[model samples]
Target: MEKITFQLPDDLIAQHPLERRDRCKLLHLDSSSGEMKEHVFADIVNLLRPDDLLVLNDTKVQRARLYGVGGQAGRKVEIFLVDKLKDDEWLCLVRPGKKAHNGDKFYFSAREYCEIISILADGSRRVRFVGAPASEIMEKFGRMPLPPYIKRDDTSVDRKMYQTVYANEGFSIAAPTAGLHFTEELLADIEKTGTEICRIRLDVGRGTFKMIETKTYEKHTMDPEEYWISEESAKQINTAMKKGRRIVAVGSTVTRTLEGCFQSNGEIKASHDETDIFIYPGFQFKVVGAMVTNFHLPESSLLAMVAAFATPEQILTAYNFAVANRYRFYSYGDAMLIS
Candidate 1:
């Protein structure tokens, strides 16, 4: 309920997504007193103990940014696919929405066709691609979900650099920004040091950028992000708990995916479903003991989640330091660890 102020400088906002997926700056935090220490992304290996279990989100990002014509030429429309309907169909939000209507025809690059089939009750439009497989569709006309800060269009480097190296299962519209900093070498070093790695999938939506619209963080319900916890993942996390090892979540998405399937008896069951779990202060964490996340926006859901992990004062202090140090902010920016 405190006043949230974001006075970050414009230069601190990362102009582009990281050129190398794993090469990012990191700030380690002591969850005890909230003290911070700066380090490179690779230094993460030192934080892992042999008995630690780390969970990662393997959900791949789809090229959600789509460009097309409205009912006529020169009426440019941007359809950002947020959720899937079929291989070549999706539920998306359209820009220049005034020009879109059911049964209207649209074009992608003047090369392919799109039709507005129906509008979903929640306001996303049902769109069908007329000429190509959705996988190939993005290769032609889709762009990455570059945060609104970049001030430019997604470039050639974004296609690869925006996603994590381990990303494979496709569903997410935006990259798991925290995982963007992990290199194969870092993963290997952590594994070599006896830390066990596991995976879950949360198809995070483009609503990731949505600002808090409610006065109370408790009042805001999260848009359901698609999630999957496999039998293997559940077994690993539950087993780690049974043995009293720490379970660290790589990002808020991973934290949500794992916590979504958890039961009150401290058991982790495997399931695939949508998750609307919003973690805020006063919530008891069921799975994650530590979290590696990115610097978040003020008065944002992401920052509220961090407040749940540590404390509001701790997070505010870290934010002030990040701003003072000129650390890059938001999705394309530096990383943090609260443990």
Candidate 2:
């Protein structure tokens, strides 16, 4: 993956989404011929066929970012909820790591407090909410978990702008970005074209936004995230596959869910499970044929996964074209459709 690198101009990073969601730029990549074209994201409906199936990750984004003071001396701490362990316990990434040691106490409000009980192997803290369940505390105080690259504070607009129109189940710290471009009207229009829509859940965790820090790609390990494919969704997907219809994943998370649950016989099982699947250039894709995704960070796993779908050469070429043409990059940015 070290070879999979790019130079992203600082100005290319989109700090905010366009006023109109579907108005974002779309880069079309033809995998077989390696040709590329630019169009508005709304044109996605025209690019699909009647026999195509669009799979979406409907994981809802939780308000996982928190700002509060901790320790007896009242030091500031930033808590990013990573996982919920139980009703009262949660696994979180805390700033000032040295101050969040075992037995440390953090106060969110006068009535809501948390105490670190143990340390996880990955340096995340396992803490117990003292005054209320962790979920309730977060609901009352947590802010939208915006990516650090956005360079702004979370605002009231983020509650709606950061979420996809169809998002409804599972708690994800981050949004399934490609879905962000779809409006309810656009989805209805897509359905009228006979392109069936199916859904799966993959809770986007803290690791999804982190850049690759290892010297070699082999050292990168994905933390397991929970996912589920319903019996109904499996039936629709299997029926489409049997008929030779295309399965178009909406984002990298959906791609991960489809590939992780795929069987050798080309069938997807309906069940809830955790997957740490890491995709790169040479991995065989079992379920997804096409995908809708956002431009990702350089040297990131999401970029590597896209590289696998469309060859590294094609993906990088398209990216260069995007940069030259001024397409917005990152979560609140433009979209790409590869087939």
Candidate 3:
């Protein structure tokens, strides 16, 4: 853990997305040779080969953060839905947790309310919706779950800016940030180069924002995220693997989904499953030949995975170069290509 850790200035963390997504910076790193090159994100089209299989996670960010008044005194409460446990029930993290004891009711609108059914060991609440369906309530009153690091409230602009142009399903709490850098025009351009693009879904969970609290990386546990790969996508990926084409994962979520679904027979299985696959230093990657990812937080599991993809020393060196060049950091920041 210490080997992969580095110092980052606070101001370098990107507070908002750029006006044009693909106009951000791109740092290309040669994993084996430790060579680095800098370019604008749009230059990604020029970096790909005709035989590259570009895989993207199409999981969309849901409007999961809601504000309501609850408790005996009508104090304000915040409900952040983490996962849907049933049709009308969800696992959530509540702000002012003490005000939301079991049986307490919260109102999102005149006709929408929910009751706290129970509290989990992790202090998250099991909430049951009443008067309306959970999806309806969230769609009407919830805000995008912007990361705490952004340090601002979600605005109407975030509905489009925070999500990728190709986002297809609303199950994830966070955007696949690397995908956020690619515009529709850029995708079309990449396809024009004969780089095959495929999609997979990974319902990114709250674990994306979780930090490493353990002293050692080995002691840290990852939260499971649900993922799915269609038979069509499986055939495309397997064909690429058999032909020895480069499998370029769009983000860490896609990287995990692909590597996790790899079978002992050396083929990707098409199925829906949950993965708590934590890629750290010393772990072998089976599926991803290259990666496109946003700059991750210091000491985060995401950074650890990048280190594993390359080397801790090489990653640290490239990170320092990015910092010295004043490249942005975090979800809405610049990107890196480790290949």
Candidate 4:
């Protein structure tokens, strides 16, 4: 774990995204050689081969953060929905947790409200909606669940900017940041080069961003995230594998989904399941020949996985290069393609 830790200046953290998504910087690293070159994100089109299979996670970030007033004092409260427990019930993290004891009611609007049903061991609340459907209330009042590192209140712009253009299913709490750099025009251009693009789904959960607190990567545990692959996409992937084509994963989420679903028979089947797959240095990768990912936080599971994909020495060297070059960092930051 110490091998992956690095000193990052706070000013290098990207507070907001650029006006044009594909206009950001792209750092191309040769994983085997540890050589690096910089390019515009739009230059990704020329970096691919016709036989490469590009897999993207199309899981969309939900408007999961909500603000309301509740408790005896009518104090302002913030609720971040973590997962849907049932039709109208959800597991959530409440701000001022002491104010939201079991049976306390909070109102989002005149017609939309929720009552705390129970408090879980981890201190998250089990809440049930009333006066309106949970989805309806969230759609009306919830804000995008931006990562805490951004350090700003989410605005209307985030409703569009934080999501990828190809997002087709709403489930994740965070955006697949690597995909955030792509645009419809860029996807079309990649397809024109005969690079086959496919989609998968991985509901990004809090576990994806959880930092490594343990001294070693072996001691850290990953929370399970739900993922799915369609029969069409499965067949495409299996055929590509059989033909020895390169499988380029769009983000860490896609990388995990593909590598997790791989079977002992050397083929991936169409299926839906949960994965807590944690990749580290020494773990053999069965899928994902290359990766497109955003710069990850220090000592994060995301960075650990990137280190595993390449070598920790090579990845850290490239990261230092990126920092010295003044490349942006984090979700709304620059990207890297390791191949």
Q: Top TM-score: which candidate number?
A: 4
Predicted structure 2: clash tally? 0
Off by over 4 Å in 4: 263-266
lDDT measured at residue 275 in model 4 versus the true structure, 0 to 100: 82
lDDT per residue as tens, model 1, 46-101: 87778999899998887878878767444878888777777778788887777888
- The runs of at least 3 residues in candidate 3 whose Cα sits more than 4 Å from the true structure, single-residue gaps closed, are 1-3, 263-265
lDDT score for candidate 4 against the true structure = 0.91
lDDT of 3 by residue, 10-91 (tens): 9999998899999999999999899999999999999988999999999889899998887776888999999889989999
Instruction: Write model 2 residue lDDT over 92-193, tens digit each, in one string.
Output: 888878878788888999978888889989899998888877778878999999998989999888999899999897789999999999999999999999
lDDT of each: 0.82, 0.89, 0.91, 0.91
Put down candidate 4 lDDT per residue, 162-258, tens digits, no spaces.
9999999858999999999999999999999999999999999988779888888898999999998999999999999889999999999999888
Q: What TM-score would candidate 4 get against the native? A: 0.98
Error of 1 at 231 (Å): 1.0
Which residue pairs overlap in candidate 1's backbone? Answer: none
Worst 10 residues of 2 by lDDT: 260-269
TM-scores, all models, native as reference: 0.94, 0.96, 0.97, 0.98
Better of 1 and 4 by TM-score: 4
